[model samples]
Target chain A: MKKILSLGLLCTTILLSQAQAASTPTVSGVFEKTVHAFAENHAPLGQIPASDLLNQPVAGIDEETGFLKVQTPKGLVLVARAAVTTTMTAAAPRETSCSYIGTLAASGTGSSSGFASNCKAGAR
Target chain B: MMVMFWIVYKFFDPLSLESATKNSSAQFFSAITAPFYGLSSPRSHQRVAVVTINDPTLQQFDAALPLSYQRQVFILRQILEADPAAVFVDFRMAYEHTDESLSLFQSVLDEAKSKHIPIFFARGEEGQDQIHLLPPLRNVESYSNALETSSAYPLLFEEGNAALKEDEPSQEETRKPEANAAFDVYRSLCTSTWSGQCGSFHEDDFRRPMMIQWGLHVDPAQTQVSSLANSPRNICAVPFSGGFFCRSIVQSFTLGFRAFWGSSRDYEVGHAYYPLTIGAHQLGERGLGTPAGSPPLSHLLKGRAVFYGTDIRDQHDDTVLPFLGRVPNVVLHAMAFDNLVTYGNHYFHEPSEVEFGHGVHIGQAEICEFILWLIFTGWMAFKFYYSHPEVPRGHGAKLRHDIRRKSRDFLSLSLSVNALVPAIFCAALAAFDLSHQPTLLNGMDEALLYVCLFLVLLGTLVLLRRSAQRSQPEEAEHAHGPEESEAEKAEKFRLGFWAHLALLTSLTAIVFALNELFIQWPNADWIGFILLWLAVGESCESTGFVLTFVNFLNRRSHALTSERVPNSESSSQ
Candidate 1:
């Protein structure tokens, strides 16, 4: 039982790393348009004071995870691909730390299953 | 130096040097040969035609930019009615006003489906998502609208999150890489034209991008117009009177220049008669409402893959190419489609070698380049050496005395010839090589090396003969010296020849490899070529300086001899 569990964990780690590498976006040329960033929980992240990147383009859409990638002045922030109409709204100041949310997502510590459920239901 | 260059090239760029060099060389070669595209323009016209929606087209429809769905439906129906081979729309019709009914657009699509016509629409970032979202455009094939530099048609596009896309297990399995708009058109055209023959080509055939061979544009002034008034048979049906005088003068000058160069104008005449363009308003204009003198639309558009694109000013979808100046983006697709039709599987692409990893490979182009360089250099060596041959001794009696005088004369002549002749020959050959630019047969450094080698070899041979002549007063220099036997002389000759051959072989290979690598690097490669050229010039100047010094010493000796003779005569008096 222990051996089987160890094997499963190894496979899962490999798959996750591959997925991360595959989802990475390459900025080919200059981008002009911008879209707002949202957390995996569909909540808006905190905006920096007098930041130039308040308006940033949607660098890429992660097809596997269904997350919209936005390059921020701090780092990349993942937004739920759902809530297309609402997510395009201007960024508002919020209480959550985007870096903390990213760390939790990367470590798989938070309740991350079905992040799009509420987004899809409330979007329409 | 060659070894050091190789080490540096590997250290900085372990890979990509081969491909980058091949790509630039191919582009340079294409630019050199672009002037001849007009010869094939007429045949290219037979394969494709473009229907442009310009400013006049909007005015005719009485609609603003991005025409309404209903207007598009009307225009699409008109195009299908003409019975074209295929139609590719270069517009992305995004979802707008969800409440609006799409039944009219759906009917037009159904009509095209019933007629068995394949109409492809330009795909944006949404890709397959849009097809799933829009019901009316589900059957319409999607093609990525990205401008590719290296190839006329790229088989795959780097799509959004390409690697992670799930595969569908079907007979014709769609891979993650989306096909480009031009490639889709070519496949459709092939199947339509040669139904049973063009069965499922391997995608790997199109993995490497072939450079776009742009075709010549039609001159409106040279287009054949119908005698009947208001006839749309001629391409002149579209008003192109904006810069008529300037165009006429340029065309006249070009014709005169070609005539002076002894080239015929058959290509121009053939292109003038080809109908490759039709305005959107003219093509979409309906039935008996069409002007009386207008020719039938089917007659022009039939059996041709048509591209539907916009040509509105400030639209910013234009590309500039040789033979054809700045043209709408759709025109590029049309030209690529035509190139595929004309060349099929035998399209011109840069020849690449099979890579077996860890940097072990053999390139055919590089091999051919080396062989040509060797052959030219060998010929140049032979020409320079034989041009200034050693003088022979006269037969019998005073042969030893004659050889001494002739050997002195030979040394002086050889030095002077070595200095000036190589310089002149190098320049002339460099000029000839530049005329045939971007080919494997042209390496300026290789020429200079061969000249230097042959010069050294000849000088050594002359010096050896002169030494033998000084030792022996009875025999000519051609015979063996008293110290050396016949067998020893023969052994020395064999050793000398083998040594010369080995040195030449190694030097040629090293120079060839270095030259090939240098030319592949972008702007930095020109510095290598110029340095090689300057090195050759420096070698020539040094030889010339030595000859000048020798000549000055001889003149001084002659002056001293004249002074001595006059003083001796005065003492005798």
Candidate 2:
């Protein structure tokens, strides 16, 4: 009985860690290919997915300012929410995988269109 | 005094001083000897080459970031094709990678192994953390025949604190077993690559981990086997064997290089192997443009151990070394490697008489030599004191005459004592270079000790002369029929005591200032010593002047008081 209880606890712990690691939305297909291409070329992407851009834990999000605060390897980055456009799949599962398409403001105030797939549900 | 000197010498070794002030006499000796033996000259025929990853070379690569592993693979492939004697990769691959780049790197290493080209990669320690090859490159270890790894850690000559046991593991016991295991892996890798077998290398062979002797050709006429047999490198007994077994040792990294390239040739000293450096753009140019006119890069790498490392400004992979000051880490490794292979058996070895312990143990011979020095110094001090007796009081004209007569003798004595400074320095330099034996104390410490001894003896002689003079009957007063009173004698003694105390206090203050200055400003140490001698001389002169002036004032006051008292007595009568 004790062994069984310990085994169950260990399984639950492992599952929890997996869940935490998978918390960040993943991208596939064209969006994934494009990011890989940009990384190879050592170029900054036109638009990066919020999950990919932020990779680490969120510090805070200011709804009024439309700023999504997330930590990056360099430091915290404040990504503007107005630049993000989310397309919700109809009748999707509770943990929905949505598509987020957006534009990144370039140096000259021009916007470049960006597309992302496999975004988690209920994420702004 | 000898005991005090010994205490200071034992505890306050100059080599163990704060890093900023520390002078590595060993390094100094090596540097000086190298030039004399033609080891450092470009004409000396050394075969090692350094291929620095300088700015221009990096600019040829994918210029956006540092050269990727894939590019390094291409560079290694180029070096391998040159059919070099061996290649030692000094850069550590400590990062984890799971990308396609990893496979590409592994394939290149596999190719090198298939070609039977011995390639040694550097292993790094991540602080006190796990020691392992970069996850991707760990596969290369399977290629046991041609591939090996060595610790890229610098071996330091630190004072040993713990006692050694016959059967038990010594200092290795103090470290984490995991770290020791990691070191063992590195050691085995080096040994297998060098000797084609694990467990061949022994701990007793090295003064410290990774300290290897470069198999230098000492006598050009002697056979390699004979030289190897005759070399007097340090050996340690196998644990628990009761001194039954021992193994000849060399450093792991140098062993790897030597195992692959073989022993260095005679007349290889002074000559350096300059690497054929190609830029990224040049590498690209070779692919795009005509390759017929340009010599093949492999042609340049042939017959050399190609070393590859970054020499960028921002990387800060530089160390401050003795003689050379700040140089790139690669240069130190190269110089050490050169020193080993070119002069290993000839130039480098631990003195057989000394034993390693908490500090170096001077053998009986050194102790005898130290005792002899003590006796010589004591004799010199005694002779100097007796020869330069103090000028007696009540012989003003005679004292002046004596001073005039002895001024040359005083000058000669001062000159003779000062001359010992350079003589001691030369003797120290000679001992270090010729016999590889450091004196009980460093040159500066010995000089300071002698100066202090001289001052103490001088002070004692002066005090003794003063006391003797005080005890003597004043000839002038006896001739004039008046004897001095006991009260007057006591007063004079009290005054003399205070003057001596004042002089001692000033001398102590001056010596303290000089010592502080010497410690704070190491570059000015010799100057400080000279200044200290001058300051002592000046203080002695000033003290003498003050004493003479005080005596003159006392005499004047005494004469005036005596005259007034007689007049008063006459008037009253």
Per-residue CA lDDT of model 1 for B1-573, tens digit only, reads 222233333335436563444334333323223323333223445667777676555544434566656556666776788787788888776455453554557787778678777787775432345432255664464564434443334555455533322532353344435566667777665556545434555556665444556433332311221111211212222222324322322333343354334342222221121226555554522222234444444345666778887766556665543222344667667766766665555454444556779997744444444454345444432322221213222342245446446755554565556446435644554455445333322133334434544454455544544544444453455455455432332223222333334434334333433433332212222222222222221211213332244334445465564453332221111
Error of 1 at B234 (Å): 14
**Segments of candidate 2 deviating more than 4 angstroms:** A1-124, B2-10, B13-45, B64-66, B98-101, B125-130, B139-294, B322-325, B347-376, B385-573
lDDT of 2 by residue, B1-573 (tens): 333333343346445332222233223222322222322223122344455554444432313234556556766776776665456565666564333345656766677678665565655422323244654565332111110121122232222422222444465466422211113333333454434322344444333323212222222211110111111211211111113222111122232233223231111111111112222223222211223344433354555445555544445555433232333444445444443333322323322246678877754333543564466445433332222223123455355447534643443354446455434643453344334312222233333433443554355444534543553445335445554342332233232553355445334433333332222112222222222222222221313332244334455465564453332121111
Cα-lDDT of candidate 1: 0.45
Q: Pick the candidate with the highest lDDT.
A: 1
Query: Per-prediction DockQ scores?
Result: 0.01, 0.01
Interface RMSD of each: 28.4, 27.5
Q: In order, how many clashes per candidate?
A: 0, 13
Query: Model 1, residue B386: displacement in angstroms?
Result: 16
| Model 1, C-alpha of B315: deviation from truth (Å) | 1.7
